[model samples]
Target chain A: MVFARARRPRALYLAYYFPPSRASGVYRARATANYLARRDWDVTVFACPMDFLDKVIGSKDEELLGTLDPRIRIERPPLNQYVWQRDARDFGPLRRTFPHTAQKGYAWTQRRLFPEHYASWSFASVRRALALHMRRRFDVVVATGNPFSSFAAAWLFRRITGVPYVLDYRDSWTLNQFTDELARPEGDPVHTWERRVTGGAAEVVFVNEAMRAWHAERHPHAADRMTVVPNAWDADLLDLPPLDLSVPAAPRPIRFTFLGTVTAVQPVEEMLSAFRMVRRHADFSDAELHIHGHLGFFKGADAALRGRLQSDADDGRDSGVRLCGPVPKTEVADVYRESDVLVFLTGGARYVTSGKIFEYMATGRPIVSVHGPGIAAEEVLDGYPLWFNANSLDPSALADTMISAAKAARDLSPEEHLSARRHADTYERDVVLAPFETRLRTLARRSS
Target chain B: MTLVDEAAKDTPGTEGTPPHVVILSYADPVPQRVLAYALYLLRRGVPVDLVTPTAPSSPTSATFPHFRVWEMKSVEERHPVKWLQYTVVHRLPSGVLNRVRRVARRVPGGGPVLRAERLARRTHRRVADLVDRRLFWPVYDHVRPLVLARASRRALASIDFDAVDRVVFTDTPAEHLAWKLAQRHPETVVDGRLDREPYAHLEQIR
Candidate 1:
C-alpha cells in the first residue's frame, strides 16, 4: 500500500511592509515571505493593504508584486488608523490654532494605546486573525515589525490558538539606534508591550549583530533565543555587467557619485564640504559631484534637502555639485557604470547597515566612505580591495580620501578592477537567508 | 407710472416751490440706471441734484440735462465762505504769488497755500482719471469698497434733507445714505432700488 506523507504545518507571517510597497524594509519582508512559500510551507501573510501604502507613503512598486510566489495568501485587513486622517476637515473637538497642534495630539493618542506609536492595526487585524484561526489553526506564527503593532496581532493569535510564535525585528522599536537611547520613557505603553511580547515569544531574530547585542544587554534572559540575519545584496542586481571603464572621449569632469537616498543621517553637509575642498585642488579641476538619489525617504521631506542643495549650488562654492535626482531601478546600473568614483555615506553606527553597501561593493568602483567608521556596514566594506575610509569627519581628510579614490578610479588595473565584484559575490541575499531558513524549519519541527 | 409726475398731478406744485429730488451714486460705469431715474424725475418737473465724486464737469454729469451737478471742488470747509476764499486765492499766477506767500507765512497769515493745494488736487484728479481709463474695471474695483463707504458718508453729511423731497440711491452701497436720510428727516422719502453687497441679507426681501 502507498501511504501519503503527513501534511506540512502552516505558518502565518505578519509584516506591515510587504510586496507592492517600496518601503526600505520591504525587501527583507519579501525575502522572508517568498523563501518560506517556496520551501513548501503554507504561508499566509497579513500586510498593510496596497492602497494604504500608496496614498500615505506615496511609493508603490506594483512590478515587485510579480516577483512574489503565487501560492502565498496575503490578506490586507482594514487598518483603522488609516481612516483617521491628520486633516483639517476631520479635526474633531480640537481648536484650529495657527501652529496646528492637532496632528501631534493625534499621534500621541496612538502611542498611548499601542506600542507601534501610530497604528490602529490591532483593531482590525486581531478580529481578522481570530476568524482565520478558527477556520484552520496555524502551527507557528512569525511576526516582523516597524509598526510593532503587528507583534500585538501575532501575540494575540498565539494566546487564542495556543500556537507557538516567533518575532523578527527588521529595525528596532522602542530603541532609537542612531542615538542608542531607550526610545521611550519609563511606564510608557511600549515598555509594557515589549516585555509582554518578548516574554511569550518562541524565538526573536534581528537583522544585525549590533541590534541583537543591544537587545541582549537590555533583556539577557531572552538573549539565547535571538539570532542575527543581516540584510545582503539584492540577487536581481548582482549579475549586471561592470562598467567598460573606457576613458571618456570628452569627459566633462570626474564624477564622485553617491547613489541611493540622501537622508538626514547621511551627512550631506560633510559630503558637500568635502567635495568643495577636493574641487579646489588643481588635479581635480572641473570635477562634478553627481548625487543620484531621492532627497529624502518620503515625498514632502524632499523639499528641505532640495532647497539646501539648491541654495548652496546658487552660491557657486563648487561649480558643478549636481543633485541628479532619483533614477529608475533599470537606470541604477547605468548610473553606477557612468561614475568615476562612488561615495558611501550613512548616518547609523554599530547597529545600522544600509543595504546600498552591498551594491556599492559590487560596482568595483573605488568607494570613498563618507559614513562614520563605527557603522555596522564598515565590517562589510572593510575587506573590499578598492575601499577608501574617510577616517574622520574633517573635510580635509575626506577631501584627501576622495581625491585618492578619483585618481585610482581613473587609472585601474584589470586585477584591481575584478576585486569589487569578487568581494560582493559572497553576500547575495539568498545566501544570507539560507541559514535562517534552516533555523525556521528547526523551530517548526520542535513546535510540532 | 412715474412717481414724481404722478405725485405732482395729485398734489399740485406751489408757485414759489419746485419739487426737489437728489440722486447719489458712483460716477464710474456712467451709473446708467441712476441717470435714467434722474432723467425721469426731470421730465416730471422735479429739480434734480446729481452728486459727482470728481469734478462736476466730468462727462457723465455734464451729459445730463435739466439737472444740477455738485462737486466738492476743494478740500475746504463745507460752508459757503471757504469755497469762496478757495476760488478767489487760486485765480492768480503762482510765480509772484509764491514770494507773497512766503511773506504771508512769516507774518502768520498763510491761509493754507491754496495754489499748491489746488495743484495737488489737480494732480490727484488726473491720476485717478488715468487709472479709470487704463485698468480693467474689476482690477480698479479694489478701492471701490472703501470709496463706496466714503461716498455714502459724504453725501449724507453735505445734502440738506429738508429741501429735497426724496433721496434716490440707484446703487447697492448707497443703502447707508438712505438709512441716514430716513433717520434725519423722517418725512423725506428714502429709496434704494439696488441690492447692497455687504448687507446682502437685507436685500433678501422677497
Candidate 2:
C-alpha cells in the first residue's frame, strides 16, 4: 500500500475573545479559527476562561462549536484578571467587594512583577506549547488582539520557542485610530513594551489599509512585513437555504434592522433622528427601525448613551423607531430574513471596518450607511449595486438619505437583490483567509 | 563633607541622637528615596516620617513602624477653579495678542485698559505659579504634622529635599522655589541632589 503523507500544518491561534463568548470581536476570531481548521491546519486556540462568564457578551453557538475540526485543540489558561464564580477560590476578600477594581489591582501587581500581566501566562503556555512543538512543530503562531496582551504573549513565545508569529491587530496600539492621539505616551512603560514586542514579530496584519500604512510609517524598517487583511463574511454561516421573498407571512411596515451593540461611539442619536425625519418627510411613514442588540456590556454597567437611546426611543413613539433589545446570535439570521433594509451605524475614526458590515453584505439587503465620508466601510460597500450611501452626519442630509434609501429598498427587484448578493461572494471568510494561510506556510518553510 | 556631617556641623546635637528627616514627595508613585530611607532607618531603629502628596489612586496610611509615609493631594487637584485659570492663561498663544488688542479697543477703558491688560499679562506667569503653590501647599501642609509627630523625638532632624524636588519645574522656577524653601525652613531643609550620595548607602543598610 502506498503511504499517504499528511498535508496539515500545525498553528497556534491566540484570541482572547474566542467563542462561545459573544464579545463583538468573537465573530472575527471564531471565523479565523474555523477557517484555518477547515483548511487542514491543526489549529490550537488559546483564550481566557473568563470571557464566558463576564457576560460582556453571552455565549450561543453550541452548534458552531460542534462544527470545528476534531483535531483542533482549544487551551484556556485561567485568566488572573477575571474571576468566574466557578473560580471563587482564586479571589480574596477585596475581590468580592469590587471585582473589577480588584482585578485591576491584581493586574497592576502582576505587571510590576513581569513586564506584562499576560507574560506570566505566556511563560507557562509557551513552555507547554514548545514541548508539543518539539514533537511536531507548529507552522505558525497567529495572535489577534484587543487586550494587546495576546500580542505580548505571542512575542514571548516566538523568542522562546523559535516559532514565527503573525501579529493580527484587530485594532491598532500606540497609534489611536480615532483622535490620532498616541494611545500610550512615548517613554511610557506600555509604549516601550509594545515597541520592543512588535519589533521582533515576524509579520503584522491589520484590518484596513490605513492601519497598515500607519504602522508602516511608524516602523519603516518593518514596512515590508506589514499586510492588510480585511474582515469578510463566513460562507458556512451563510449556507442557509435560499430565502424566498414572495412568502406571504413576512413582517409588514418594512422593518429596518440594526444588529450590534448600541454605544456612544456610534451616532445613535443621528440614527434615531434620521429615522424620525424619514417618517415625517417620506412615503414609508410606517417603516420601523428595529434595533436588536445589547446597549453596552462591561461589569454589567449601563452606558450613559444607552439611557439617551431609551429617551430617544420614547421621543420616537409617534414615529416608528423601536429599540427591540438584544437577540441571541443563533437567531440573527431570522432577524436578517425579516428585515426590508439594513442600517449600518458605526463610530471611531475613518479606518474602522466593523464586523457587522460583512454580515450585512451577506444578507443581500439594501444597506443605508450613516457615517463620515472616507470610512473603510464605504470602500467595502462601494460596488454593491443596491447600496445607499449617506456619507454625512448632518441631520437633514441623513434624513434625506434615509428617505431615499427606503424608496430604493421598496423598489428593489428579485434580480437586483441577487446581483447584490453575488457581489459579496468574493468576501466569504474562507476565501479571505486563504492568502493568510499561504503566508504562514511560506514563513514556516523559510524559518525551518 | 557628607550630608550627615554637614548637618551635624550646622546644628550641634548629641552623638547618641538619631537624625530627624522631613521629606516632601508627590503622591503619584511612592517616593523611592523615602522608601529606601525608611527601610534603612527601620533597620537601624531610627524614626522617619515621609511627607508626600496624597495618593491620587489609593488609600495611604502609616504602614511601616519608625517610618510613616504621609500622602497629600496636589494643589492643582484641590483647587479646580484656580487650576482652570492657570491652564487657560499659561497655554494662550502670543499670536492671539492682536485679537485681544482689537477686543480691548471696544471696552470702556481703551489704551489704559490695554496697559493694565499688559501689566496683568506681564505678572500672569508669577501669579499663576503663586496660586498653584498656595493651593498645592495644603497637600504639602497636611503632611507637616505627620513629619513633626514622628521625627520630633529624634535629636537631629535632617530633611531630604529629593522627596518633593522637581528638576524642570515650569510652574515655579526650581532655583527660586529651592532658595525660598531653604530660607523659610532653615532648620529642617537640605539640598536634594547634594544629599543624595550619602543616602545611597541606605539601600544596603537593611
iRMS, all models = 25.7, 27.5
Residues A1-448 of candidate 1: C-alpha lDDT, one tens digit per residue = 9999976768888888887777778878887778888788889888896657665666676767877889989998776442323222221333122112334455565766674533566557777877887887677888888878778777887787777788899889878878878788877888788878887888888887888888888777788888888777776744567656464435457888888878877778888888888888897878888888677766456656765666566653545677776676657788887788889888867788887888888788899998776888877887899999877778889999999998998787767878777888777778888898887777777777
Candidate 2: tens digits of C-alpha lDDT, residues A246-344: 655444687788988777678888888888777776477788888887666543333365566666554434557666766765677888887878898
Look at candidate 1 and tell me the lDDT of residue A33: 79
For each of the candidates, give the backbone clash count.
0, 10
Off by over 4 Å in 2: A1-7, A55-64, A82-90, A93-120, A240-251, A315-319, B1-206
lDDT by residue for model 2 (B1-206), tens: 00122333433123433454544443346545545544554555444555444442222234444555544434333354434544554556333555677789998768887886687667765765775577644443433333332332231134443342221111111222233345445443433331332333333343
Expressed as tens digits, the lDDT of each residue in B1-206 for candidate 1 is 00122223333244444557777665444465666566565555556777545443333334545467655323223333433433433433333455665665776545667566556657655654564466533442433333444444554566566677666655433444444456667776555442121121111211
Task: Candidate 1: count the clashes.
Answer: 0
Q: Which 10 consecutive positions of candidate 1 chain A have the poorest summed lDDT? A: A90-99
Instruction: Estimate the TM-score of every prediction.
Output: 0.63, 0.64
C-alpha local distance difference test of each model: 0.69, 0.64
Clashing pairs in 1: none
